[model samples]
Target: MSPLLAADEPSNLPDLEILRAEVGSAWSAYQDTKYTRATRLIPGILADAQRAVRSYEGDAQLQAKALLAMAYQGAAMVLTKIGEADLAWMAADRGLGAAQESGDRVVTGSLFRSVAHCLLSNGRLTAARDLVTDSAGYLEDGLPDASPTYVSVYGTLFLVGAVAAARLDDRATVRAFLAEADAAAQRLGQDANHMWTAFGPTNAAIHRISAAMELGDVQVAADQGPRVDSSTLPLERRVRHTLEVARAYSAQNRTDEALALVLDAEELAPEQVRYHFISRHLVTAWVRQQKGKPSHQLAGVAQRLRIVG
Candidate 1:
């Protein structure tokens, strides 16, 4: 068992609200790119959530299970970010179990998305695509008058599926998945972070940029990636999209532009840039290609990323 899954006996059990707030805080830490803080908080949150599950019963028990699911999902995301793919899979699987027990369709769907993410991280592109599609289909049938949370998770699933399809170079499937996500965004009518999904039209557009990048349409990604104002999205989303745009620029040999974007992202979220594979990869390549000595800015960013002295 992962240390993250290990539970400690609490002297006093925290109520559902407390657990929810802790989970929310951990998520906020993650979005703010404070990965270390997020990881530190998660184990305790998981332990407390487990205690809640053991102590509560009836509806309270179900709610506790939901919190556990969210906690585990957060763990998975953090683990994935830190390049712990195996542990992430374990966390995601545990979250799925908890989500099922919670009997919350939205939570279940969200966990399904997390599981697909784990698959994607592990290079199981086909499995990830199939899982997202199947989960989206299952959720769609049950959501007659869907809540915002339901719509967000349902749509986000297709967005993830689009990414998986893009990686497979399946243009048709990618377009179909994006269209489904866009339709869901239109139904929701605005950008909302329901259940922490951050799903909306802007997010759909961001996914299109991602798909373009995955499909090796560097020009399209470079053109469209920068124009979309992702300011309305979460900090994490904004930083990630910025990195993607930087990648597009790099692919086009727009080294200066790419370096500038990388710098900008680093300023916004230093931890994210330091830990992100794209930023590290780009910096490493720049350092390797330098003639005698790299530029001041390049050296500075490279040093910060620990890729140079």
Candidate 2:
């Protein structure tokens, strides 16, 4: 085992419910865009989850493994956001192992998404798409009697697959993936955070905007991005959608609109804007394009993103 996953010295077993709550709290911090807090909470969560897994048996052990999988998933996500691609991959791999052991198909599917995300971060676009495809296919066989969690994870896989296809400039594949996601969302019937996947109709629409942006369909992105209501989604998803629309506006040279949207995103989640490569890249480009001193708003955002420093 990697030192990162090494079991701690034997100690009192953690309460399963408490350990689960801690894992949920870490995910909450992450979705709130409290990256530093989430990062701080994860290692402890993982250690406790590991301890719980070691101390439990039968169903309890399985449940502990599920929590361990979730904790690792959270770690992978935060690490990915902060540019720790290698560590993110490790966390994702570990999460997958735990999920398989837990026999939780939803957790397993979700971990597949995490691994695909790590692949995407590493620029392995085809690998990411193939992983999503294979995993979603395996999970699809359960759709006849799928629970909400299963549907959510299954749908979300296609959403990420859409992104991978978009990045590869495979418009047909992107469309196919998005269509699958939309169908799943429609079956789901409403917005939900099932298994921490904000997979629903609105979220599917947001992914459409993301896919459009990735495929360089600036017109499609610009036209649809701002119109979607992401208020019902998680704070993280809402802020990310705002950033995508801001990027669309920027692409159209609607500088004032783009700047306004970015500032709006900053208001929603300052840390998200500060940590996001897209926001930083946009601010950097805007600063460089200015003939003289940039506007106060732009300058302020630049400073917050540390692009001016």
Candidate 3:
């Protein structure tokens, strides 16, 4: 088990609202690729949240516990990006348990998204797909009269499921899930972040790029790349978009373009890019394919990231 999953009783607990806001701030730092800062802030927040849940009752306890789940999910996201899949899944599992206790469909659904991501990152594609599929089915009946929160969660569930299906080469399942996600996105009308799911037309479009890559349609991934405006997305997502574009370029043997895009991603989110398996593998492969020594910039990043000696 991850030490992050260990419970700690906080010495001093802040106001519940304050703790909640701080957790949000920590997550924002995480999105900005301040991984160490976010990790430093998480343990105390998790401890405080645990205390709050224990000390409160009814709605207050539920809300506090939901925040705890979100914090754990944030930790999971960071852990996975840093190549800590086992620890990441441990955090995700903790988040899932907390979400279940919270009994908020939106929170539960969002954590399901996090868990599916962990599974996907660990290459458990089938499990990832089935988890999202089962959860989507469970959440379906709640969608009609649901708030934007539930709508975003529902759409993201399908989005992750679509990606998993695409990776599994189940093109039919991919299309079906993407269609369902698109329907939800259509209902929402525009891009919006709710429950941190970031599900909307724009996000669905981003998924299309990744899905194309998963389906071995590298050209399609490259072509669809320009459609996503990075400036419109959060820093985390912008970095992800850039990295995916880099991957598509790499697949097409456009090494220069790929390196440039990856450098852009590194600039946007150094911590995320520096530790990501894709970044390491791409750099290593790109360098090995070169006829001579890598260019200075490529060599610099590779050395800094320890992708090559």
What are the clashing pairs of model 1?
none
- RMSD list, candidates in order: 1.9, 2.0, 2.4
**1-309: candidate 2 lDDT, tens digit per residue:** 132554434566788899988999999998999999998888888888887888889999999999999999999998988888999999999999999999998899999999999999999999999999999888988999999889999999999999999999999999899999999999999999987898899999999999999989999999988789999999999999999998998999998999998999899899888888789888999999999888999999998888863
Per-candidate clash tally: 0, 0, 0
The positional error of residue 177 in candidate 2, measured at the CA in angstroms, is 0.5
Residue 142's lDDT within candidate 3 is 95
List model 1 lDDT by residue over 1-309, tens digit each.
234443434557667898999999988888888999998899889888888888888999999999999999998988888889999999999999999999998899999999999999999999999998789888978667999889999999998899999999999999999999999999999999998888999999999999999999999999989899999999989999999999999998999999999999999999899888889999999899888889999999999999963
The digit string of per-residue lDDT tens for model 3 on 161-278 reads: 8889998999999999989889999999888877666678888888889899989999999998977885766787878878888899989889899999888888878888998766
Reference-based lDDT, residue 217, model 2: 92
lDDT value, candidate 3, whole model: 0.85
Instruction: Give the C-alpha lDDT of model 2.
Output: 0.91
Task: Indicate the TM-score of model 3.
Answer: 0.94
**Where does candidate 2 stray beyond 4 Å?**
1-11
The window of 10 residues in a row where model 2 has the poorest summed lDDT is 1-10
TM-score of each: 0.96, 0.96, 0.94
